[model samples]
Target: MSIWEMLAVFAAGISAGTINTIVGSGTLITFPVLLATGLPPVTATVSNALGLIPGSISGAIGYRKELEGQRPRVLKLTVGALVGGLTGATLLLALPSTAFETIVPVLVALALLLVILQPRISKAVQSRRARTGTPAHPDGGPLLFIGLTLASVYGGYFTAAQGIIYLSLMGMLVDDTMQRLNAVKNVLAAIVNSIAALFFLFVADFDWTAVVLIAVGSALGGQIGAKVGRRLSPAFLRALIVTVGTAAIVQLVLR
Candidate 1:
């Protein structure tokens, strides 16, 4: 790769890291950047997945305060994400692109709709809980399992706005402040991306220049995302992510 290409990847990494930390949609940034640099679709997807692992890990670590008391829960739930991510990645490699293409638009649209409804739904759920005088959890085990499993499956497959899916699920199924759940989201997302990245690094062809550049920049941007997260209201960020995710879905649909 030329110096310019390496720089472009590094820039993409920074953009992805910040986007992932703040709003979720790091894939929307890095994936296209790599594709523009001439990687095949699958290769770009896999390589970006690997490179963005650090950003996820970084964001999780940055939220250590929120994670301080949630270790056991995180461990239990992380397995679902791990399994789902591997399943998704393997499917990506093994299944024909034609099959994936047919399914992705539907998934993306559904995911975006979830993103769009997050605020209103969360408020309504909270209001219902308050009126019922119930403790934080109203749904219990089956709901928790289903929600995590769904998030994991989505994370494993394609994590454009996986945060929205997780935030909505965790908000409904678990009782925690949005900030605290955000920490859990980072950890689960990290496990999904990090594991897939490790697999790709060992098995797939990658542009190492792109990987290194993105990894470094994303790591830095991730730290900043965590630092700034609470200061900024997430309403606008969610709106932007949904907008971009919708655009990406539209592009895919056209293709």
Candidate 2:
């Protein structure tokens, strides 16, 4: 790759890491840059998945405080994510590139809608919980497990707004503050991405230079996001997610 291309990927990685830490959909920032560098779609997707793993890990660590008392929740949900991620990775390797391309825009659109309506959804969830006098299901019952598994499968396939999907679902079922639920979302996303990365590492052709650049940039960006992102207003963050998700849909359609 040319130095300019490398620089662009690095910059995209920084933006992706920060966005992933804050709200998700970081793939929208990085995937097109990889394509511009002349990688095939599958190669770019897999390489990007691997490159962002460190950033996901860093972001999860950055939210360690919020992770407190969430061990059982994390452990239980991780199983579903792992299985779903493996299933998605296998499908990615097995299916034609056109199949993934066809679905990604729809996924982005759904994520955008979820971001826009999350406040109403949260309120409804709170109201329902109060009316039923049922506590939040930390274990995330069968319905939550199924939903998470599906989201993980999507994350393994595209990874754009997987975090947004997770946040929306968890907000309804997990019965916690947004910040705490966000912490859980980060860890679950990391698990899904890590499983997919491992699959790609063993089975796919990837650009090592691009991966390295993204890893370095994303890792640094993760730390920056963790330190500063918590202060941002939820409204601002949700707006940012919607904007990026809309861009992702446009990019997919144009491509």
Candidate 3:
């Protein structure tokens, strides 16, 4: 790759890491940039997954405070993430590249809607629970587990907008502050990426240079993103998620 292209990928990595930490869909930034550099689609996807591991971990660490007392939830959800990630990674290798193309935008759009309506939805659920005299489950119950597992499968395949989906599900079901849900989102993202990367290491092709460049860049960006993300008001953060998610849908359609 040319020095200019290399710089561009590195820059995209930083931006992706920051955005992934704050909301999700960091892949939208880095994936196209990698493609512009002439990497094959599958190669770029695998390489990006590997490269972003550091960033995911970094972001999770940055949100460590918010992660407090969420151990049972994290641990339980991780089982689902691992299984879904493995399945998705396998499908990525086995299926044609375009297999998921038609449905991905629709899924992301739905996730965006959920994020937008989460407050009202949560309120309604809470009111219903009050009427029924039902106690809220600390770990978001089985439905959240199932929903997140399904989302993780997509994340394992193509990570763009995965965080948005996760936050949408967790925000509705978990009954926590958005920031705390985001914290869990980061951890789950880290797990899904890590597991997928591990799977790719054995069975997929990767551009080591791209991986190294993104790894370094995203790691730096993760810290930056966490710092900035923690400060935003929930309303502003929700707005940002909508904006980024809309852009992701447009980019996917154009692609």
Candidate 4:
């Protein structure tokens, strides 16, 4: 790749890492840039998944304080992430590239919609619970496990706005502060990425250069995300993500 393309990928990695740490959906940033660099869809997905692993780990570590006393929760949810991630990775390899190409645009669009509507959804969920005077299941019950498992499968496959989905589900099912749920989100994301990437190593093709560039950059961004992301304006971040995601859709559809 040219120096310019390399730089672009690195920059996207930083952005994605930061975003993934804070809100999830960092893939939306890197995936398009990878495509712009001429990598095929499946290859880009695999590389992105592999590259973001470090970022996810870094973010989880940064949130260590919030993770206190959440071991049982983490352990239980981990099973789902592991199972779902493997399932999704298998699907990616089993499906034809043509199917992935067709389905991804639709998935990206849906993910963007979820990102856009996330706040309202959270508020609505909270309101419903309050109205019913229902208490949240300490372990998020079967529903959260199922929801997170499904989201992890999606993450393992495409690595898009799965974080947003994670937060949304946790928000609805678990009665915890956003920060704590976000901490768990990072852990789950790391697991899904790690598992899928490991699977890719055996059966999938990827661009090593893309993976390295994104890995280093995203790792740095994860630290920055943990330290600075909370201070940044939520609205601004959402707007930037939506803008980039829209461009990605255009690029994918045109190609």
Clashing residue pairs in candidate 4 are none
The parts of candidate 1 lying over 4 Å away from their true place are 123-134, 138-140, 234-244, 247-255
lDDT of each: 0.75, 0.85, 0.95, 0.84
RMSD of 1: 2.6
Best by TM-score: 3
Clashes of each: 1, 1, 1, 0
> What lDDT is reached at residue 56 by model 4?
93
Q: Write the per-residue lDDT of candidate 2 for residues 145-240, one digit (tens) a residue.
A: 999999899889888778878876776566677777778888998899999999999998899998998998888878887887677677776777
TM-score of each: 0.86, 0.93, 0.99, 0.83
Model 2, C-alpha of 211: deviation from truth (Å): 0.9
Q: Model 4, clash count?
A: 0
- Model 3 scores what on Cα lDDT? 0.95
The parts of candidate 4 lying over 4 Å away from their true place are 98-135, 232-255
- Candidates, ranked, TM-score: 3, 2, 1, 4
Global Cα lDDT for candidate 2: 0.85
| Tens digit per residue, CA lDDT, model 1, 104-148 | 667767767766776777778778979998666432256766677
TM-score of 3: 0.99
Candidate 2 colliding pairs: 25-160
- Local accuracy of candidate 3 as per-residue lDDT tens digits, 1-255: 999999999999999999999999999999999999999999999999999999999999999999999999999999999998888899899999999877899999999999999999999999999999999999999999999999999999998899999999998898899999999999999999999999999999999999999999999999999999999999999999999999999999999
